[model samples]
Target: MTEMTLDPRQLGTGGLFTAAVPDLASHEAAYGRRPSGWTRSPLLRELEASGLAGRGGAGFPAWRKLAAVGAGRPAVIANGAEGEPLSRKDTALLRQAPHLVLDGLVTAGEAVGASELFLYATAESLPGVGQALAERRDGPRVTLVEAPAAFISGEASAVVNALETGTALPRDKAARIARSGYQGRPTLLHNVETLAHLALVARYGAQWFRSAGTADDPGTRLYSLSGDVPAEWVVEAPGGASLRDVLRLGGAEPSSLAAVLVGGFHGAWVPAEAFDLPLTARGLARYGASPGAGVLLALARGRCGLQASAGIVRYLAESSARQCGPCMFGLPAMATVLERIAAGERAPWLASEAERLAGLVTGRGACHHPDGSARFVRSSLGVFKDEVRAHLAGACTAHHGRV
Candidate 1:
């Protein structure tokens, strides 16, 4: 598939708006060099003080992450592993604006006093990033590492683990990769888009960068909008913009809306009536959701929310590495129950089983899979209670025995 070109200005400072870059070659020229303003810039310090969070789903503070690996011969990992099937923004950015991404990685390494740069990407994305890196001979020391294609393998720590051990798998502990990553050296891991933003911010300074986004969360973000949307493409928008605005940008029909799933499979389902809600880490939390990886799956009115939830559950279950006991046993059982429920089977007890499984998996795994799965399933039950009740009453009109 030919990669779409995005306008650098679309990635510009005015909140989230569509800008087209056209193609890779054009984007490289636009990327040029690190903005001279970044030299001796205190933006990283301000970003730390400003509490800029990771846009790559976790929402962890960027400054804290950088601070975690204080001045040293640290290594920087530009995590470009876009694992969610629904998310294409990261890979799209890499393929289209590889130079921008490379510039960000180099600038970030320089900011944190890191000497080594490792750009970790899925095998599918390796070629694009590698080519981009090859064009740059004046940047910081760098290497491109291809990670295995797996769902959870793209998590920040997982990327670090894979780079160090040459294994594309998540570790069995909540290991702080910043403390000891990449040959037991302090490492700073960030999403490709996040670093790209850093490159610009480092050049423009915080005030100039802050002019485009919300006060609390300053900057633009890329969202992957799909399902029942007319304009199903990656969108660039300002942080804390209303969800309604994003939906409109995606060209979603008013009648096609039912509930919108913010975040990915691990996110929550908010009724479409609440589309006016702002899109922010804290705002989504008010609705019992996190913008996990910036995926917005809009379900149409006729679509069965429970069945949709079931399909996602099955996917998450199958994606599990099976390293943790709770995730191994609980996710499969939960998916089975969701499958039965989606099939219109009268398994009232299955709901209880899902709840029980959620309890077991919430915080018991080495990774966030179990927690994420629990959130996905638990939120489905909460959001689709009426549907579950209808299925139990043998009156489910959606997906009757289709599973």
Candidate 2:
């Protein structure tokens, strides 16, 4: 496993050690509080005022989501089904700070007038989270559900489908799960970490929460910082911190990094020269990237970018749910182009084929698969222009294995 370094200044109070399970009695004594003062605190409003964004990939405003679900008979979902292969932040939170996550679920349920809470995780994640839920006596009104471990199956709609009918498959776009989820009720689905933040906001108040992050996007975010560092660890830092700061905090050598993949496979690629960029959604947008799912992969210079991208493309292609024509057909075609490019093949029609497939897939699928696949291939071509050129030139003989 590659080592990753995290900067201390960018980290939250407990930093990397925050996820370590503390003594239950001590944790309860310090964190456990009866559900009271709900109306007085105006927790949801305060969270909106504080500008707390979701720690999940999309960085959606937490308050906005709460307001969307408002005080009604809504359903709250803790999305622990982290489908990204390279990311483990959610799993770590579920395993270590399960109580905190549950607290957030309960708080969100209260704020949104949601009486029912559901905790959904991949089948592999069920045991740990289930045990954690069993240990808690007075938290949210939640039920644990185990979803299929397929990559796309962990998506929100897929989770909802699994919860409703025990089928871990994504529904058609026309039938968005949020509009009619879990027994036909309005639902507010959030990542487990997002709910945990809500619990903290409810307990500490939003001003304190806002004190750490940026002016626009407040509160901390958990990132699975991997590759080219001293330690591969999960780090929590305030939103909008400099990527440079995060790299340094993760003990990564600033100069050696060739590029950073800001989001997971679905995110854009940014060259190392852009490290000075802030880690907020707005900051990343300037670079045509978003920290989707908070995965930062550092690539070394000698590594072939085409090879790295080809591996991810293959993974995405294989992970396709095969529910739609575009995603089912287009991803494999894109994967073939990437593999050929990585292998130093200059098929005259490769570029155009990729573009055609990208066009065919974009926005045609029920999920973001088409868009994410397109972005992955498009960013690879743009960021790895030199590599694509080299492959066309037949210059590099070494093929770096999958990333």
Candidate 3:
């Protein structure tokens, strides 16, 4: 697998994982005491009231995913396999606030009738998890499974396949893993941060969880803010906070940016006009933006958006699992056209042809890889409309050179 080099830094003042060395006793003190007994059904109802959503990019409702856990021995897998190149909040949380994440894992495991809790993490994150696990004298049955660092390796299906089949590729089957996962039993999986919030929700109840952000997208979330910033920061803000506010928290001046990629590579592109929208799932949906994996990347002033996009597309092409024809063929084709357009090629069919290629591969692959790639391409086209026109007119606003 190819190694992606990116900054994995964090803010020292945030609520979670900002500590240099957070201990278990301090975690318990900050979040209040833990529960001795937990019932799955009641906890599910509480989660429904909390309006909590998954932090694993998709933002699916947490209560609903827990409800899908099948009858047999269930499992809770904490996904610390944060594979998005521009994201590093999970890594920071695992290293800094491990006990809180562990509280979440143990709490969630009991809520789902899970026989054991699985901690799936990239190899780089193991030492901290190991340190925390070693500190724990007693807890639920917890096991750590190290995963190879790759973009798709953190995906739910891929994580399952890695454990069951020893391959990090996503399963070709169409069924949801919540019903049949991890030893052919029901599984309750959550991103590392989301599970931490569950520990909060279990103690404070849903109303307390809903008190911070909007009613639709309640609670606070962590955002890995990078690209063109003086320093990278992992911020914890309310769910519906404006992108403008989040950017400021990340030490970015909104006026200085050409555009910002609200999500990671597989997410949307929003120009400054869309910056006013809230960073919530429902709010960003108004502008077709997904705060996927809570990544906020701003383009450097005068940096070529087209060139940057083409480079990202090429990375997506290189990272494909090659299971389906569309992912294997369509992505590389899209990247080629994108690189050409970024080079100030005066081809009229380039924009339309890029869209056509994206459509052919979208929603046609076994995993969401093709669909995500298409979203990235479609949003880039709209966000860089003026840039696209300039390229077609044989002029370059940023630079004509290749990425």
Predicted candidate 2 versus true structure: per-residue lDDT over 1-403, tens digit per residue: 2322242322222332453454446446656663555641387678777777776666788877766653347788989888887787777777656777777787777766786999987666667667766666656557888756667766777888888898877877666445577677778889888887777777777787787777866777777888666677677766788888777776678788788888888887888878888876678775568776788888877777778888999999999888898767889989988888788775656766777788888989887777888988888888887777768666653344222
Give TM-scores for every candidate, taking all chains together and pairing residue i with residue i: 0.90, 0.90, 0.93
Maximum-TM-score candidate: 3
Q: Pick the candidate with the highest lDDT.
A: 3
C-alpha RMSD in Å of predicted model 2 compared with the true structure: 3.3
**Local error of candidate 1 at residue 181 (angstroms):** 1.6
Count backbone clashes in candidate 1: 11
lDDT of 2 at 222: 77
Residue-level lDDT of model 3, residues 1-403, one tens digit each, is 1111121211112344443566666666665556747777998999999998998888888899888888788888999999888888888778877877887788878877788788999888888898888878777767888888788998888988887877889875486789988878888889998987887788778898887778867888788988877778777777788888888877779878888888798998777787788876567775478777898888876888888899999999998899998888999999999998888888889999999999999879988898889889988888888788888777777665322
Candidate 1 lDDT at 10 equals 33
CA-lDDT, candidates in order? 0.75, 0.74, 0.81
Instruction: Return the lDDT, model 3, position 25.
Output: 68
